[model samples]
Target: MLNKKIVEKKLTSKTYTPKVLKELYKIFNLRTKQEKQKLRKILLELISEGKIYKDSKGKYRPLKDNLAIGTLELTRNGTLAFVWTESGDEIAIPAEKLGNALHKDKVLVEIIGKWYDLPEGKVIKVIERGLKKIVGTFQPRGRFAFIIPDDPKIQYDFYVPVEYFNNAKPGVKVVAEIVKYPSPTRNPVAKVIEVLGYSDDPSTDFPTIVVKHDLPVEFPEKVLKEVAKIPEKVTPKDLKGRRDFRNEIIVTIDGADAKDFDDAVNVKKLQNGNYLLGVHIADVSYYVKEGTELDKEAFKRGTSVYLVDRVIPMLPFKLSHGICSLVQGEDRLVMSLLMELNKEGEVVDFEVTPGVIRSYRRLIYDDVNALFSGDKEAYRKIGDLKEQLFLMKELKDILRNARRKRGAILDIEGGEVKIILDEKGHTIDIIPRYRGEAEVIIEEFMIKANETIAEIFNNFDLPFVYRVHEQPDPDTILQLKNYLSALGINFKLPKKIQPKLLQELLEKTEGHPLRSSIERLLVRSMKRAVYSSTNIGHFGLASYAYTHFTSPIRRYPDLVVHRLIRNFLKTNGKLTKKKIKELNKKLTKIAVHSSKRERTADEAEWDYTALKKIDYISRHIGDVFDVVVTSVTKFGLFVEIIDKYISGLIHVSTMNDYYIYNEEKSILIGERKGKIYKIGDKLKAKVIKADKTRMQIDFEIYNEEENKSNIN
Candidate 1:
């Protein structure tokens, strides 16, 4: 019999390096094949239990004393990077060294080699599994089956017995729960818990993505019941002690397809030649009290997810689209930020208070934009509001100029794709969502309101949630400068990096051939904005303090801000120190949870859009289109179709001659023909293949001369 104690003692004796399996077997003096098998099993058990570790060379060794804890990031090509949670240091882990640790898994890694600039580590133990369930296509092999996961990060297929099929047959999309985790010698076992539908059914894509991302699509029954008990209209009793803005000419400006309205704007010219701007947001905290089922559910959702064809709201429809929504001509409770600003766009004074508002009109951005463009029909539709719209344009210009002077970074080249779906949920067309003057005006107002509220709460010295964006790392900035220099654009980095320097560079390269590419790179160089309990000044906005004070119906953090302001109002600004301390303890957790949920929602939205794009392109396979090379890698060049904005790979194998990648020049060179392809190069290509399951497309360069000769 193989004993763990004896093997451990021998392995720990005097080993600074890993030991191979054959050497371990020889050390144990195992004579028969059966004994060797038992010894291997014991070694595997020890490795799994974190008593030992494996390196990339397939050698086992004892774990080091100082193991770093981090989250594993796995790429589609099976590469791994470990991001330490505490120190923010990154370590590279070879694919072979990651035994059972999956993508995004919290793991304890032991440093094994320091040959490269960055340390290399091997995952010794998986502290927590990131994925508990997976969505995939089932492939039945007679009595048993295997599930190929849709997520490329899951490198292994799941095994399922016949009895665990849950009535699902082959070629069906299903969600499976992992029954047992993976091991070296055996695949992971899973049971089909939900049979979504056919793999070819377009309607199943939404639900499959929803389940895959663990997004909460529906509210709990208890939450729905609580929503049912809430009043549908603002009564006289509900307006007590609330400032009434019913007579104000407030209007909501949104997209044509917008359903839930959470914010409204009203502007008036004051006697002092300044403007009085009113930004009223839905008071969601009024209905959803603390310690209630609705509040619990709202906190869990964190933020509303806007997918391609649908919206998974944080709150129920009864609140998001009904009484709590700031609909036109409806009495709704709100938290209003009224600011008195001078002509220079400086807020002279501001007041935050709970209020009752009745929006006079609900306007779409297109119509408002047309009105500004002097369209007669649009002017007639706007009628008496045209003058106020003109005044809004003036205020918007002032505010925009003020932000520019303060060095707010503006990278506005990219636009979102709006997928048009038929009644059957099939994608018909994809168009870019335009952002015009009206959109910019609304954005400016909301930003001012958010900043003003943040300053108010910050002055109170109370615990609150803030929207923070940290400055980019120095190394990332230097990399951007180097890339720009390589493209023949002379750029210099200031001793102290500021938003102004980047903004000026963007302006200088605005009309350049690589303008869009440069903007994309600069955007990537910036840090992602997130929610935090402590106020870290927003670097991109150039604001000293900021919070999300608008859209309470869709975002939970906004609702929390509203609650804090309301409590301050109710107590006449006399909150006890003990109460403030309790809120600080609670707000910290909420900030972290909300930030994570927001990221998940953004990822889900991007995934759904990509899937729809793949489906859309699948119909036009073999069609040649003009494309621009967005990036070049060792494998191939990534090109984006001109008008369609769909990106695909032009694999090196598709070319007639062999190609070699030049890392320093960021280009691909043909070995025999000496042909070179670099970023921003325009060429024609045919869509050779589109894989809907993988959400990928492949393209080949079009040979125009050959085609012409063939036609003759």
Candidate 2:
């Protein structure tokens, strides 16, 4: 049978050499017309799937032959695009070679030659359009209208006919769905689907973003109906066959604005120099059964998107914020992971069980952090849970230390942004999100729980979904090593790279002035953490087995994890080999879908947050602020305002003197004055312009002397 697997096995078994159709047929030992036809069809199918590519000479070969399928990544300016191939090679695509492919479009690129040592390719086919609709501002043209896309990488102003304008007036924000994709000579055409009031209206932000990212805004009617049927609170029948932890002092700790409390914790200093730590996560899987409308919607959303203004939930509010939320004093069903750990923070034993719990108290991060800092009022609120709170802190420290010792990268700072809004829904401030002792405690406890649960499933060799971050590509690591050597740092990379190697390098550069630059480069060298059915292990965490087990209310993977745990418990871990085989296929699909949706969520969050950041910057135009140079390119410098936590560009053209880019040092130097601007360098800059439609902010070097001269 000439199926995909058989063909793949035969083709990959030996060294691949470019071959023609007749040669392939001969190789397959097919003489009959029927067999030859089947072979040809199969080969065509493989080509469509990007498994094989036809060389420019009309010979067939595997995709390794200078051709690959991946998303098209346009530069911030959108003049050039690059595609990171499946093999991790970044192939540059020139504007003319793009062939109408938009940014983030899944595309097949045919590599014709090399540009600056990197493979340069032209988009041969657009596999899939990344966006169904785009958010832009409506501009009236001669006989039609044009939409200036908010996304910089869109690269074209969409032309809209007067009839398709949907009554949207000039200067109004509108959502446009492309009716005709662009060609080399002409722009794309679109029809306005939604007419948002104006660019400045805050209410339009979520709608604009939701459509832009294809995010599920409202729950389906079927999903809402299912949620409506779900009980408002945990019932007596729900407690059957579940462990009771209601009597224990469990507390839910989260940010002040958190709507759903998913995980709760309680700690006890056990006898014989051990710690009993309990992690109780809301049992979202119980309420959202597989194959139901609710489950389908949750799977589609994959995870909750928390915007600056509101949350786009994965599940309906009736369940996510009601029964599934671990609210204080309310009985809630939970999948509880109880682990007994030694003083060194190694889990000696653990148990996972369906349980019922009533949160004893709800504590916010601020209060807990204040209590840890010896604030009397904060401690007074702690009251009866003071002893347990301190014990939790001790265990948190031990766990963090153990993780550090086990070679996990702990010092890479990735803080969130706290957007402060006023009653008018305008962004007042954007500050770095604070994660104090309480947040650290929760993070450590959740990680321990996830590891413990994943380890148990791995020990049994079960088919399960694992959160994996594969090792960095050898080429990327080599580049990192070379870059560090230029900075006068001798870093050694092993033949087989390991997390410990990079972790040690980070440790050595902990307090170095160039630590941020190093961190940025090191992070770039590593692959993204993603969901996978097979466990290759998470290199960043240095864990042999790791899975997301908490935050079931917000994340679909956690809910699926909960369901798998329930299955394991019901079957007593006696799954047959055949059953596991079946599960492998199902789990693989789930992992891929969940991972894709997760990336979507991340991108949506980033776009929304960036929009708000630009809005905040618009209010402060011409104001001088201290900024740090986060990146330096030949065209400009990217600087983040120190206090506002907003980044903008200081274009090289605006500088008083022409600047030359120092490629080796990755800095910009003035042609005459030789003033150097490099990463981590602090300088004062004035915001020159802020364009919401373009989603861009331009900054210029602020000269105090020039300002005083002008005033005088």
* Candidate number achieving the greatest lDDT relative to the actual structure: 2
Worst 10 residues of 1 by lDDT: 81-90
Query: CA lDDT of each candidate?
Result: 0.84, 0.85
Residue lDDT tens for model 1, 578-674: 9888888688767867876887798788888888888787878898988888788999988887655688999988887899999888889999999
Encode model 2's per-residue lDDT on 597-691: one tens digit a residue. Answer: 88778888988887788778888988999987777799999887774667789999988898999887878889899888777778899999987
Checking candidate 1 for backbone clashes, the offending pairs are: none
Clash counts for the predictions, in order: 0, 0
Model 1 has a clash total of 0
